[model samples]
Target chain A: MPHTVNCQIDHLSVNIQPGATILEAARSIHIQIPTLCYHSDLCVAGNCRLCMVEQVGADRLLPACATPVTEGMEILTNSQKVRHARKVMLELLMSEHRSDCTHCYKNGRCELQNLASEYLVQDGRFIDLVPFKNYTIDDLSPSIIKDDAKCIRCQRCVRTCAEIQAVSALAVAHKGAEMKISTFFDLPMAEVVCTNCGQCVTHCPTGALVEKNYIDAVWQAMDDDARHVVVQTAPAVRIALGEALGLEPGQIVTGKMVAALRRLGFDSVLDTDFSADLTIIEEGHELLQRLREVIRDKNPQVKLPMTTSCSPGWIKFLEHLYPDLLPHLSTAKSPQQMFGALAKTYYARRIGMDAKNMVSVSVMPCTAKKFEAARPEMCASGFRDVDYVLTTRELAMMIRQAGIDFLSLPDDEFDSIMGQSSGAGVIFGATGGVMEAALRTVYEVVTGREVPFDGLNIVPVRGLEQVKEAALTISSPLPEWGFLDGVTLKTCVVHGLAGAREVMKKVADGSCDYHFIEIMACPGGCLGGGGQPMPVSDHVREMRARAIYRDDAGKAIRKSHENPDVVKLYEDFLKEPLGHLSHQLLHTHYVARKRY
Target chain B: MNGLRELVSALAQKHGTRRESLLPILQGIQAHEHYLSDDAMVEVARALDLSTAQVYGTATFYSFLVTRPQGRHVIRLCRTITCVMHGKNQLLKELETLLKVRVGETTADGLFTLLETNCLGQCHQGPAILIDDEPYTRLTPERIRVIVAEYQQKAALESENSGLINS
Candidate 1:
């Protein structure tokens, strides 16, 4: 009957909203309730049990996070008992967690580390209490490392993996102290349909889930006199690399990033955007050919619903979850791979260097690209196309290790030949971006004229919505194209494998009728990748997404097809789209894996 | 279906198959089958993966898996919980008497899996178990047996044939 509930904050009476937690009510009046497990973006699981407060007439102190505040309830947040309980909770958590924070990957930035310092937990009572036998290692995956020894069992990683990313790759298996977060059936991470998006790593309170560091390999490459090390930075990497340099989260550091790479011993600082534009040129041609085949005979042999093959995580998902739809995926390798291939071939010829002497490195915001680099199918360049794959964080660490003053370094341009790219190429950092980019080029080729859409935003193919759809009307000069012929190019965009699963269901049931689809393994595109930043939220996603579009808008070239470097690349090296050279280097096939 | 004697009789009526062929049959059903959607015996009978009699034989064999369409609410009480507490004997006695069924038997109304498990891996919460797939901590015999009975009564209302039981 009463919506307003009276609750006391430190024995002071305050009316609060019904169904509000004690922490929520306390925070309204600036009463700080310290929390470790409570991430604003995620639902409260009350696992850490650190947010405890004493309620009058209650036998035991209540967990403020789990407890709902009631009317006329007196609460004591800083009582002796409450302090003791929170301290004990922290002690227990610290005991189970690895205390060697100095050497830990999450040393300075870990939430648990911050909590321990804030709570003044000098040492744990059970400091030497070894975690149970389940503190084993599972790092078969190229991108992820799972060392349960450091895990706090906060379930933040599990919740983020399931709720935010919607991959649901990790779950608490077994139970109690022996329980550990794991992929389905305790299978190796590489064996599962885990898109190496790294959301789990971002959400993890400790160093349990982490991106596999390839900085060592990059260092080795730099040390080798015979090796010509080339580095390509992903668009999203430029926007988020600032955070690693102690700059603001959304700060654009493209110039400093280039200078940092030059300092880090990269022979050339290339842009993945250049390769992204190339992907558009080649993939755009592939789409036209496929469309011609579809129109010529409408043969089922032709993969009608062509899915973008840019994200390795999505490629793996296609391999595992939608094996039947493998035909639908584009044969073109991702921009990272494409860049590596061109550096070995086109760049090698221009510089009069041997391809084997060149080591192409990619600094990406994605962990899946690590897996993609290791893939047997990715050696299209006669060597590993991209030899070393480092995340934005890893590159930042390397930059710091190399004593590069990242923040102070003036902005610099990427190397000529492969540095020039369009806004369409830069937008590949966001979800539905690849689809939007592909449509921009494909629509023109299909109609023999530029399609309408100011700045080519393609409003329907933009946003945080998991699945986005758009229809394009084809017209003019291309013989097959007529005024409307009712030829609406049906397109769908899916981010996250869980969303991919729903679309997959439609394809499996023969109900999905989209002509083209774009799938990103990470939610919010590569911007929310596991390797981008720690504790990624809607704020980070928005910041990074806005920064990516901003980078796109600031670009001199805005359309992928119109990139002069790409045009020259086609004429000088590629010969043409779907050409002998392009096919040999860029295209790949997928296989159906048997789950045992 | 209520007693071991009646269960034996039902097995006799259902058996055209031999016992030796059961494991593969059960494994096939678990694998090829999406969930335990078919009658355990019928699924056993259809295992081209195995012979019908062989499947029936396996269906009756494994204590870990179910052979019958289980209750809508399947109570997977951890025997490991009680055993670790050294109260398993007492817990089993209480559960059998309360549910009016043996440890391995489903009630006349199928609603629970009252079987003994080696370990659900929850040693800290000794005498712990799961009810309808949700973990219950610090389970006592009196509380657990009652929980099982409530679950069985709930499971009986839903047609066991159409529902899919994971455990």
Candidate 2:
């Protein structure tokens, strides 16, 4: 057993494992020492002195985040000295910070703002000495904006970009007064290797980094009489949108979300899950085609271990970092684009409305979706398929703007044709959902039996593990899939981009073999997206994942191929999974880029 | 690297191309090339198993190390309190008039580039300027003109011989 250190805090003694910081020991006994730079998901950077604690014999107060507890150490967590030190730190941060909280995007949700209010710091004692850095706001990227004035140099965004995403687009440049977070040689964000993932924005504690707002454009479209503002909600948004509207974090709010959209002046409320089902049929068949080429024809040139292309951040990541392996990525567009294409062509014609007159909008649990919608190839119907995309937080703002009582609103149904979805579509919000959805259809179609898991849930593929592996043996495949019989299909799910980097390294060296790999750019898939409600922790993501799986289990139709509307979509417009029309609208090629 | 391939490759071999050797490699390149070129940064990144972005970021963080191709004679005028208090403003104005360039610009003849920096740790020698690592202390406008003339004369002679140092 490891040696333990006993620390006395606020007259309560607790024993903790050696090498534990005072912050960890205090939190174990529920002492609640506050810290600004300390995050559950990052390395301990003791730059912020917010969590100062007085040691009995020490000359000065020590930061609880970085100071490890010694044997029989007596610590004062909330003494006058610690309180005064914390207040001064908060004042200094506030003095340098560009305070326009009332108009800032992160106004009520900022961590520094909350700490200042809690500490009762009326004003700063020192002069605001931080000089005005005249960097042009990088609005060149479609999704996020980086403002230097509001940054406090906490280094959380830099850590998030490097440690989690494996993309060092933001780095701490210079020293002391001139120090700031910057891209390579302080280049404009669009020219750098930023994947437009917005993970850095998600981890930022202040208003320095935020998603590009589209609420005004959505409002303008709603006000225009000729424009029919149609709305679609992503599968992940339903599980997380409630948090933005003051409800609990993990409740499935699909019905209330649809009702709120109707009240907010959208002509028709639709579901992106419907197109997710169509994506399954298309992507699943594409995988089958590759498998047939490799196994049946023994084709060496065919790309194996096909990667999913549903996450736009992951797509762009591959584009910038691993362009030579582009052919290995599935060509299927994300569910958002698939919905946008069919909405303008199939749904508009079915409703007897002009495609140009309809303004299609999507509410996603992602910032990359905004970037995905603005891509040049997305204009399939002679117009931008998705006119504007709003995040889940933005939808909550719209609901508030409309003065709708979201909690009390009646549970309403989505409009018919593009509204129907299956449990497979709902699970797409979680890390392993896409892979499981594909397996559910692919297994049954090939072997003529449902997946052996309880309620068809692939338990191995589900969880918060960075990389998860699973193998399934195909026995007595249906006559058409005779080549796959007795073949043990290897598969894996990579939850975070850092994990994907490791998986990619192994794949490149032929160290690990897998027939399929599912990769999500964000930590816990879309439930932990860059644009989700702030203060996201592992517990919050787990709660949201539970809600997603529960919703899937409760649904009547569990497989994507079983979704009625998607079958009709294939029958009426698409003709087949990878037909000429499907290729025109539902698939895209990636562009290679320099890593620097 | 067409011109610097031999020098950079030689320096990289001496330093053994590790992450810890990045600083020494950058300092060596700056000493030989006057500034870090993007191509040299890429080469260093490849040798050290680091990304080019990281290499560029580190190079830009220091005040002395520059990224852009510098002038033949790089002039660093001290902007610390002791120097600023010692008629540094008069010296700066006189130098700009003498060189026909502002604080960060190179001369039209590619002879000199003026820059402002913090402390040079020579508090007693107030109002100091470093021209190619040689410091001139307590300079007057007349002295500044002579310094400019010396670099300009050398630049003209080097250009005539087709052996200019700026490249």
- Give chain B TM-scores in order: 0.50, 0.89
Candidate 2 deviant stretches above 4 angstroms = A1-3, A129-132, B1-17, B38-53, B77-105, B116-129, B134-157, B160-167
Q: How far is candidate 2 from the true structure (C-alpha RMSD, Å)?
A: 2.9
Residue pairs whose backbone atoms clash in candidate 2:
none
Q: Model 2 over residues A277-353: C-alpha lDDT tens digits? A: 98899899999999999999999989989999999989888888788788889999999999998889999999999
On the 0 to 100 scale, the lDDT of residue B93 in model 2 is 95
DockQ of each: 0.04, 0.49
* Residue range B40-98, candidate 1, lDDT tens digits: 43333332322222333334334445545554444555666444575656666777787
Each model's Cα RMSD: 10.7, 2.9
Compared with the true structure, what per-residue lDDT tens digits does model 1 show for residues A57-114? 8888788888898878999999888888888888898887778889988888888888
